[model samples]
Target chain A: MREIQVEYFAALREHAGCGRERLRTAARTPRELFAELSRRHGFPELGPLKVAVNDEFGDWEAPLADGDSVVFIPPVAGG
Target chain B: MKPFAFSAEPLQPASLRRSLADPRCGAFVSFEGWVRNHNDGREVRALEYEAYEQLGLKEGARIVQEAIERFGVDHAACVHRVGALALGDLAVWVGVSSAHRDAAFAACRYIIDEVKHRVPIWKKEHYADGDSGWVNCERCASHAQPPPARQAGR
Candidate 1:
């Protein structure tokens, strides 16, 4: 198991009920971690989302490390 | 000046244009995105924008660099606003300078499109009914379009 920080924004923040949190998980990949948290927090449906690890864009299946920071990015609407 | 950045205060378009002033460039093109009062037929009251600073900065810079190289523009810069914004406020701005109009115009369009698709910025819009929704979130697979406007006499 590893401990990591998770940050949420926009709709995700609302669903998560907080902006950031620390959690311990046994999930080896980001996809698994997200799925675990989604079930726990009842997060809204994520459409075309992106994941970031340690402040860099990361693949869904990237391995997690202790003390890493993960962010789930939703579809952007910026100009 | 850095090619791209975010400002919480009002965006100064004139200063941005001045920064890109060059005697060699014959064409300068810019695009501005403003906060409109309505979206999908809902009356929008205001908007709040957020970004993951660490990744947003890096990706935003890369997009400007790509625009400059791909469009062969002399220079390109973009500024997006964060925090609360009222109606008609400038949400984002892009300015590109090139030796010719073609490159400048193309680069301007390219930067905005890339930023929208690649950047981590998100927007939450407040509505008149005391509810809000994220721009691209909270949607079902069935996205219903707004009904047509009723004619004045009807």
Candidate 2:
């Protein structure tokens, strides 16, 4: 099982009431990883969100490694 | 392609300018987001911002790239503050640079607009009356599409 690092922000952070998490996954890509987390955590809004890997913009299909920093940023309100 | 560091404190024009101080940069344009005391008619006390780090930065960079692709620019930086903010705190800021003023100005505007409409950042508005509500990106709202025009009904 590969370990996935997760970070949440804004409303998702508020809803989850946490900032970061590390979990084990049998998932292959970012989308799959998120889907698994959402399934286990009941966060339906995880979809339609853009993701990033190692500080660069990436697609949901981006493959995961043993220690990758994955962030799920929803549509945020900014200036 | 450096990201304009977003924070929860007041934003400084000098610092932003410093960040864009590249010798190759010929033109610079910036957009300042101030703390509006009112929202939809209520007195706003403060606002809180939060985001997913990797995703937010990636989206911000993508917005910059899109602007460069669409409008042509030398460099772009977009920063947004989060956490509990006061009445007059800086909320968001964007800076764009290019070899020409026209591209810089337009790209800066486009970057800000796209970030507001596209990025996954959320704001919680704290009102003066001790009430608060979350403010989502209006442009991203799934409802209310543009109305179709009549095609010379005959």
Candidate 3:
């Protein structure tokens, strides 16, 4: 099991009902971790997204380590 | 000053413009993204912008650097606002300076476009009807539209 810190933004934050959380999980990748959290939080179907590990853009399949921070980036809209 | 940054307070474009002053550069171009009052047929009352600052700043700085390298511009800077913003507020500003007009114009455009598509910033618009939605995530299907064509007789 790995302990990870997950942060939410925009719609994910609204749906997840919190901005940040830390928990222990058996999931090893961001994709798997997101799936577990989605079930727990009822996160909406966000369509296409990106994941960040340790404050850098990360691949969905990247391995997660204990005490790592992750953020799922929804489709961005800025001008 | 850094090439890209986020501001919680209102943006000051004039000062940003002055920052790009250079004796070698003869042209300056800028773009300002304002908080408009409507979107996808909804009357927007206000907007709240949120960003993953760590990634946003990193990506944003890379974009500015890319603009400088790609277009050969002398200097460039961009600032995006966070938190609540009312209608007509300056949401973002980009300034570029170059030895000529062409590079300045192209770099300015590149910075703004890439910033919109690449930066990890999100906008949640509050509508006049007491409804709100994230700009691209919640209502993207309806918001997508064809490229604008030039009007007759400009």
Best by DockQ: 1
Top-scoring candidate (lDDT): 3
Order the candidate numbers by DockQ, best to worst: 1, 3, 2
> Residue A58 lDDT in model 3?
78
In model 3, the Cα lDDT at residue B64 comes to 97
TM-score of 1: 0.91
Off by over 4 Å in 2: A28-32, A44-47, A61-63, B1-3, B14-28, B40-43, B54-62, B65-76, B96-101, B118-120, B137-154
Clashing pairs in 3: none
lDDT per residue (tens digit) for residues A1-79 in model 1: 9999999987778778999999999989777787888778776665767788898888776679999999888777786
- Give the Å error, residue A2, model 2: 2.5
Q: Write one digit per residue (lDDT tens) for candidate 3, span B1-154.
A: 6899999999999899999999999999999999999999889999999989998999999999999999999999999999999999999999999999999999999999999998999999999999889988774332222112221100
What fraction of the correct interface contacts does each predicted structure contain?
0.43, 0.37, 0.44
* Model 2 Cα lDDT, one tens digit per residue, B1-154: 2764557667777887787777887889998888889998889988877655445676777788888888878778888887777777777888887888999999988988988876656788888899786674333332211112221100
**How many collisions between residues are there in candidate 2?**
10
Give the higher-DockQ candidate: 1 or 2: 1
CAPRI verdict on model 1? acceptable
Q: Where does model 1 exceed 4 Å of error? A: B140-154
**DockQ of the candidate models in sequence:** 0.26, 0.19, 0.25
Docking class of 3: acceptable
lDDT of 3 by residue, A1-79 (tens): 9999999999889878999999999999887788898778777655577788898887776678999999988889997
Tens digits of per-residue lDDT for model 1, B1-154: 7888999999999999999999999999999999999999999999999988788889999999999989899999999999999999999999999999999999999999998888889999999999998898767333222112231100
